[model samples]
Target: MNPREHIPVLLEESLALLDIGRDGIYIDGTLGLAGHAEEILKRNPRARLVGIDLDDRSIRKAQARLQPFEDRVDLYHADFKCIPELDIDFPAVRGILLDLGMSSYQLDTADRGFGHSQEGPLDMRMDDRNKLTAAKILDKYPEPKLAQLFREYGELKQAAKLARKIASVRRTQKIESTTHLRGLVEEVCHWIPQRGKIHPAAKVFQALRIEVNQELQGLGEFLIEAIGLVGPGTRLAVISFHSLEDRIVKHTLARLSRPEYGDSVIDILTKHPVVPSEDEVARNPRSRSAKLRAAVKRPHGS
Candidate 1:
């Protein structure tokens, strides 16, 4: 597969919620391959983009892809959670988008260790600078800690049994490879390949990936901070791939929509989460699980 190919999930739905207008600043918090960013720029000639991503490789790719609008674009190689702290023009910003999902480029690449079916070293750090690796977690974490990680992050049913199996295996040989860990999960979960059933190894990989990157940490706080920073009418669109993230986004938006001292933070734009169309799913199978939610900030004194 060509890793360069990327299809942004719920593209039209996200753009509609953003309600892109003329001559305003926009932010792409998770600018993976500049797919959504490019679309924004392409549609609005007067708009400027501020793109951020934790992956340096992805940033470089986005840079080259967005070369046409380099003069009007600002790209940052950092996590989206830090945007609230970063020196940004908060009030003038028109829209912001956060697509929280592993890009196809990362999964398709063999060395990234994000895919379970492929054989690679167990290094699942989204930002490679992070000291934590999937191998380190497998090698260092005790059986109970491993169980907790799988149970909480992956929501796996056989977490304890799988953890016990990993603990037993690591006693003699170090769990160093993706295939090594995947095989253990399959064995412990009782190997089965049936239609419409997800593989146990996928859950194991997801748990490890979340741990390695600390993906869910501080997400709700970031949303609150961002909503408070942006001006009234600024729209925030978020596309979350898994239920855990979707739940957090949903609850946070709901909380922000309530009034405090006769002033609410945002008006919920998406009453229900928007999902991908059937044609989009057929075009990009990886986007099938995506759900998009959005809200617009309300006036402070209103």
Candidate 2:
């Protein structure tokens, strides 16, 4: 697979929810490979964009793919949580999109270490600038702490057994690569063919990635800040891959839409999250788990 290739999940549905206008500013908070950004620019020729991504490699790829709209787009090498600090005035922004899934490029690239099916270094930092790595977490965390991480982040049923196995293995040799850790998980979890076809180590890898990047730590706060940045009637859409992220998006949007909450800032556009259709799933299997929820800001004081 080409490292630059990424099929933007739920592209048409997201565009419809965003309601892109003729000449307004839009923000793609997780601009991976410019897949969605390119389409947005194509649909609304005069629309300007603010693209943000933590991965420098992604930023570079986005820059190249979106070069045709260079004059209208501002690419930033920063976390989406820091959107409020971007010099742009929030009142003028028309739309905001947050896709909380890792891109195909990040996962397929062996060096980035996000996949369980391939061999790579146990380094899962989304931002290479970060000090922590999955290997470091395995080496430093105590058995109890490791168990908690797996249970809380991955929602794994055998977290304790997996943690104990890792602790015992690391004593004999350093857990330096993806294969080593995956082997440990398979040994402890004992994959059951009847349960599901999913790999036993999948959850463990996901848990480590979440911890290494602190992905869920400030998500709700970021959503609040993003909501504040849009003006009246402007929409915010988020695509979350896992239940942990989907829950956050669901509850935050629900809270802001309630009349009992101060001022009723938003109106939930989708009562239930929108999921990809069977055709979309067939075309891109990775998008099978994605769920998108959108809300539009209520007219001020209405």
Candidate 3:
């Protein structure tokens, strides 16, 4: 599959909120396929981009897709949370973007072990460089800890029961593949009455991915650091697909944009989050869940 062709969700809404300036500098903290980065560059010839991602495949593909604008873009193989140390040459970045969803490539690759349907390794680390994998967590974590992970992160009502089943299954046979885990989850959840379109194992997989990547924890820190790095009039935009991530972005932006709590450094741009349009959702179902929040650095005394 051509990884470069992965469609970025809410593309128009994100770029619109960014309000790109011709000579400005920008950072795409979650540069998936450089879809948004490419558009940002096309909007302004003199604008420069610092694109970063934990996924090595994403970095390589983004580099190639953005190579036409070689002079204006720099790709990095790092997490957004570590943006403070990236080799940014620009004096003041005018815009920062965080698209916080796993890309189509990641979910579809199946070997990466993100999808519940695809039978592959139980590795869920966004950065393959990381040591921990889902299989390790399944095998090593105690029942209490696994239950806590499922309850808190997955919000599963039967967290304890599910954890017990996982522990029981792993003892008899190694839980080293996606299919193995999926079957285990299904066994425990087959009794749950269908009420909506969501799969029974969706939340479990989501929780594991978040835990594996330390996504929420890293996001909170990254937002604070990223907000402090931009200059006055700079814009920050975040697109979150899930409620957990959306909650973090929503609260962080609120605190930063507040005149009382904050240092009066930024102003909230999107009073309410901008969601994907109905047409966009129809075209791409994945875009349906996206919510975009934006804030701009306030001019001194404004």
C-alpha TM-score for every candidate: 0.97, 0.96, 0.94
Write model 3 residue lDDT over 1-302, tens digit each, in one string. Answer: 36334778988888888988547789998998888999999888988999999999988888988888999888889888888887775347888999996898888888999988899998988898999898889999999999999888888877999999988988888898888888888888884547755775777888888888888886876787777766777888999988888998888887877777555467888889899888988888878889999998887666
Give the deviation of candidate 1 from the true structure as CA RMSD: 1.5
| Cα lDDT of model 2 by residue, 93-156, tens digit | 8889988868989998888888988999999988999999999999999999999999988888
Candidate 1, residue 37: how far the Cα is off, in Å = 0.4
Q: Give the TM-score of candidate 3.
A: 0.94
- Expressed as tens digits, the lDDT of each residue in 111-163 for candidate 1 is 98999999999998888788999999999999999999999889899999999
Root-mean-square deviation (CA) per prediction: 1.5, 1.6, 1.9
Backbone steric clashes in candidate 1, count: 0
Q: Estimate the lDDT of model 1.
A: 0.89
